[model samples]
Structure formats: structure tokens, C-alpha cells
Target: MFRQMFEEKYMRFPGGRAKAATFSYDDGVKADKRLAEIFAKYGIKGTFNLNSLLFDCERWHGRMDEEQTFLTFYNRPHEIAMHGARHIFLNKVPLPEAMNEILQNRVYLENRFGRIVRGLAYAYNGYNAEVLAALPALGVAYGRTTEDTRTFALPEDFLRWNPTCHHTDPALFEIAEEFVKRDPAGEFKHREPLLFFVWGHSYEFDDADNWQVCEKLCARLAESEGIWYATCIEICDYVKAYRSLIFSADGERVYNPSAIPVWLELRGRIYELPPATTVQFAKEL
Candidate 1:
């Protein structure tokens, strides 16, 4: 018999999906236009981390203009996150300087896009403990780092969010293959929602002459029916909502307090827990 009482309670993505995939591309560059097209073609969503000061800065031909940014991402199934106001290394500067960099970028993006900007991809993957602690007060919700963990695991800390791998990792397709085949319910030994997060700069494809990397990855993920394509912010928000669920002492009922709907797995059975509603399970622990 299954050890239902001892089994860990797991969660699923929207629509009761066990697997979810998200991409993060840094820098608002000319190549992002092509990258956005590839994502759109595959019906995938991702986040673009941009440095507002770099727009039309003319330091190089690759920098995108405000109009280019809007045309590529506006009204699209994607997100815009901060990469610092000037794309400087946050760890090297004073704490206030680092904060200003993020705040200026957030303000510009919010004013331009007419939406609250709260996510970040560190400029140069640099940050200190103080800067991380300062993010939430700055209205930031999650931050992405360049450290590639090479595993399908949810982050322990959203402020220091580490992705599964970079797009250019040699094991990119191998990892995607593993992600596509795994059935979360079947893995009784380890049952948790899987997140395949990939992070990179769009201009790297142009520099390395490897645009096929993005195309191939997108096509592979798009073919999978079980994977939920989501933006970085959406994933963070959903995870928060899932963690906010209140449970009864007997573990037979749960209430989702957040506005987002959640899917809970109890003893291998999946249950849809709607926002602000309580769900009672047939079996008690």
C-alpha cells in the first residue's frame, strides 16, 4: 500500500500540469527581435531583462531603440524585467548606487510599458547580500542569476533565483529531453513540480552564430503537451500563491488565499484548488 500519510504534498502548474518551462533573455538588443519571433512561433513565453539607459545609447549597433523594444515585446506573451539602469555590476558598487540603478530602470520601463516592473536579471550576474535584501522594498519580486544548476528544481529563494541552465549549455537538448519525459506522479521517491528555466542574452546567438540553439530548444519544448509555458514573473507569483495555501489539521482540506488558482497533489491524487476557495479531499491523513 502507498504511504499516503508520509508522502510529501506536491503542487502542479496551472491546469494541473506537473511541468513548466520559462526562458529569460537579458539585454534589450537588436537580436531580441529575432529571439522574440522564435518564441512567438513556438507559442512560448519568457522575460526580457533590459537596461533602460542602453536604449539608443549608440555604444554599438546592437542596442535597440524604444520603438524596437515596444514592437518586439508589447502585447506579446512575454515579460520585461530590469537589468540595471546602465547594466553595471551591482556587486561592485555601493548599495545605494545599486538600488538607484534598479529603481531607475524600473521607473523607465514602468513609464514606457504602463505596467509595474518587479523582476530582475542581474547585470553581469552580480549582486551582494545587501542588494538582494533591498529588492523587495524596491518593489522587486524575483531576481535571476547566471549560475546554472542544471536541474529541474524550484528555487529556494526567489531573490537569488538560479536557472536550470543557459541556452548555450552543451547539454541543452539532453536536459530538455529529460524534462519532457518525466512524470511527476510516477516519481514516488521525489514528487515536486518541475521547472525547466533557461537564461541567456539574445545577442549571444548572433555573436556565436548559433541561432539554431534557440530555435531548436523552442521547437522541442513546444512539442510537449504537458509543459506549461509561462513568464518568469507568472511562475514566481504562482509559487507564492501555492505556498500560501492554508491546510486543516487533518490534512483533508486546503484553502488558497491568493488570487491565483493552484493545483495540489495529495497522496498522488491531484486536486484543483481555486483562488479564495476551500477544497476538501475524500481521504484523510
Candidate 2:
């Protein structure tokens, strides 16, 4: 029985980490600079959503000039994602308008950052089925929503991905405590990869005068031994690569066709499969 358990095969995150935690913040507001600093202090990774049209736009408080600041202050480890060109409500708009919002913003962000912009967090978390369907063709791989699941499981559909919780979720501390207490090495019925995805707008911290909420959350989640701290796109790309792996008819050999390497847990050991490479494993009975 011990040998059989050792022979069991499953996908593991990079570095053999048992879980991942990522953050998503929307709107390219000035407050994001401070938020980014906080995240950096805690070694947290996140994706920042920006509306190309909103850059340098004046708000009731003052002009934000995010176009210049984003290029200067945003950390390289984090990602820049689209939040629509005009920050319009997609669910309320015509399909063409919605498409234009996403496509135009994607083009601008790609050109500005010199990185392929493939992730989106809906403006106002306002998207319908049509909006979701239009994303893939626009080169978007995942779209995050505002719906809070308050659980640590990976999303079934990336386009409609719901986060584990919002930063302000009344149960935020409680959930974080539970997440930290989970012992991945111990036997559990659910052996799938765990993800704690937190999403919110950086401006909210300024509004509520509660930056400490984020500070405490990050401090608690930082330096977790078995957790992978990653951006949304990084997590999505890795999972996609893992899912694209091919196995032989007898399941003794596996081929990785993706450009990114994939990790597999077999018999209590982690193995790395290089890109465009094949790995053969001993069959277990």
C-alpha cells in the first residue's frame, strides 16, 4: 500500500510547491504605487489591471498620470493587465463596444509594456456571456470576476475565474488563518493544487483608510514554506502547460510539448519535465 501511494502521479507547481497565492488589483490609480510597495515588502505577487484611457485622467481628487507612473514605479515582477479601454460596463454595453474596449486596451498595453497582454479583470466586474466568449479571440487567456468563492481551489474556467475572496471579505483573516494551517504534506481527501486568489482595487485602501488590512493580510501570507507566490498570468500559464502534457497509451511515458517546464509529483518525489522533452517512468503494479 505504501508503494502504491508512492507510485501515484500528479502535477505539482514549480519548485514542488503545494499551493499558490496571487493577488489582482484593478484600476491604474495613484494609490497603486503605495499598494505595490506594500506587496513588495511582503514578497507578494499580483496583477494590476489598467484602463488605457484612464491614464493621466483627472479624478475628483487630482490628475493621476498613471501612464508615466506605471512605466516608472510598477514592479517588474508583477503583471500589467487590461481592465478595458474606457472602464465601461461590459454587461451593459453592445458586444462590439465591449470587444472594442478589450481589444484596444490590449493593443495599447502590449505596445506600452512590450509584453503580451493576455489577462483581464472585467471593468467594474461587469461582463456577460458575450464578453467572456469574445476574450479568447482577442488573445486573452483568463478573465477574473468579482464573485467571491472564499475557497482555495483553482477555477474551472479561467475566463470566468472567481477569486477566493476580496481583501475586505469579513472572513479575510479567518480564511487566511485556515489557509496557513492547511498541511499539504499530511493526507487529505482533496489532493488537487490549492490557490488563494485575492482581488480588489488599490483605491479602496485610500477610501477606507484601512491600508493595514492589506498589510496584515500580506504579512500573514508572506514567506509561507510550501506556497508559490505568483502573478495571475504566471499561474495560468503554468497550469496550461501542465494540462498540455501528453502521456503514452500505457501511461509509462510522458511528453511535454509546452515551452514552459512542468513538475510532476510521483511516489512522493517531484520531477521536472523540460519543454519539448519526453520522460519515461517505471510502471507500478
Candidate 3:
């Protein structure tokens, strides 16, 4: 009997690595300048969520001006995401108002940065059924919350993407230690990819006078083996591309329709499927 091992395939990050790390920080404040430098030093990437209406607005407090924004993020390997137009609690407002805030914020960012902004960080960690339902129509690919899951697991739903922990979590270092020490290939059921997502506001460091916390954390994770440090949108795009792979009838061959390449592990054999190419497998392992 010819057996089909369609269910035996597994997905990996860009370099065939099963572990990834991404960071998200909210509010465009001066502290982000230092944070950006720290991330650049470690070769890490993250997303900076900003309120479009707050930028260079005299009435707003602690918001970065256009010049400061350029100085902080221009040369950095980071992403810009919407955090509402005025940091409004989306769910508290009407659905149209929420969508308008998101759209205006996205438009302003796109105009300034010349890139389509697709990620969102809910202002005040607030959202409801209505706001969530309208995100896709407004062009948001994913939304982040303040909730912490405290584990290195990918989100089942990207819209409610809860991070592993905030940077200020008391066990931040311990959790980072766990992420670096765990081996995904050690067990069969745990063979899926793992992600360590950390989210917070850079201004929090100034309040606590603990910039060293992030400095040390970045040092701990910098250039670790088998770890793909990416921005939130990068991770989202990679996962989506991986999921879009198509399999042949017998599952011995696969096609990657997306423009991004994807890695797969089939019956313990690793394979890289380039963009728009089909790969046929050898005899059963």
C-alpha cells in the first residue's frame, strides 16, 4: 500500500530554523532613540507603534516630532505600525470612529514612511468584537494586545496576538533563558516552531530608570544560534507564506505559490522550497 504522509510535514522559519524572536514597542517617544540604538547594536528588529495625531502636536505630551522620528528610526531595521490617531481606546469609541482613527493613522504613516502600514497595537490595550471585525477591511494584517502568555508559542490568531511577555515582566530574563535553552527538535509533539514575543513601551524604561534591563536583554539574545530575530510584520509574512504552500495529491511533492521561500521538514528530512517552485520528494524516508 502506498502511504500518504501529508500530515507529517512541518514548517520552519526563514533559515530552516524552528525558533524566532520579535519585539513590539508602543508610543513614539524619545526613549525609543536609545532603544533603537540598543536593538541596532544587537542586530535585532522590532515594530514601533505610533499615534499619528500625536506626532509634532503641541497639545500632546512626550510624543516625538518629525525630526526626532527620522533620527530614531530612519536607518534602523524596524517597522512602523499604527497605534490609533490619538491613542483612543478603540472599543470605547464607535466602530466607524475606531476605523477612521486606524485608517488616518495608517495613511499618515504611509505618506511619511512610503510603506503600506499593516500592523496595529491597540491603544490602551482596548478592543472589542466590532473593532476586531473591521481590522481586515481597514488593511491591518495583525493587531497586538497587552496580554502576556508567558510562553514561546505562536499565536493561533494573529489579530489578538498576545506577546510572550512585556519587557518589564518580573521573569523576563528567566523566560528569555527558557526560550534559548529549549530545543524544539528534542520531542516529536513539540516539533513546531516557537516564538518569543516581547512588547512594551520604551518610555517605561525612563520612568523606572532601568534602560539597562533592555540593554542586558538584547545582549542576552543577540546572534544566538538557530534564532531568527525579526520584526512582527516579518514574522507574520513568513508564517503566512509558509501556510500558503500547496501539496500534491500523494503529498510527496509541494509547491510554494508565495513570493517568499519557505522551509519544511518532512519525515526528518529538511527541504527548502523556493518561491514559485515545486519540489518533489524522494522515496519515503
Q: For model 2, name the residue pairs that clash.
A: 6-267
For all predicted structures, in order, the TM-scores are 0.95, 0.92, 0.93
What is the per-residue lDDT of model 3 for residues 9-57, given as tens digits with 9 covering 90 to 100? 7788887887899999998987788888888889899899988777775
Q: What TM-score does candidate 2 get on C-alpha atoms?
A: 0.92
Please report, as a residue range, the 10-residue window in candidate 3 with the lowest summed lDDT: 1-10
Q: Which candidate tops lDDT?
A: 1
In order of TM-score, best first, we have: 1, 3, 2
Clashes of 1: 0
Point out the higher-scoring one by TM-score: 2 or 3.
3
lDDT of the structure predicted as candidate 1: 0.88
Kindly list the per-residue Cα lDDT of model 1 for residues 76-161, writing each as its tens digit: 77899999999999999999999999999999999988888899999888998999888898999999999999999999899989
- The global Cα lDDT (0 to 1) of model 2 is 0.83
Model 2 alpha-carbon drift over 4 Å, by segment = 1-8, 58-63, 72-75, 283-285
Clash tally for model 2: 1
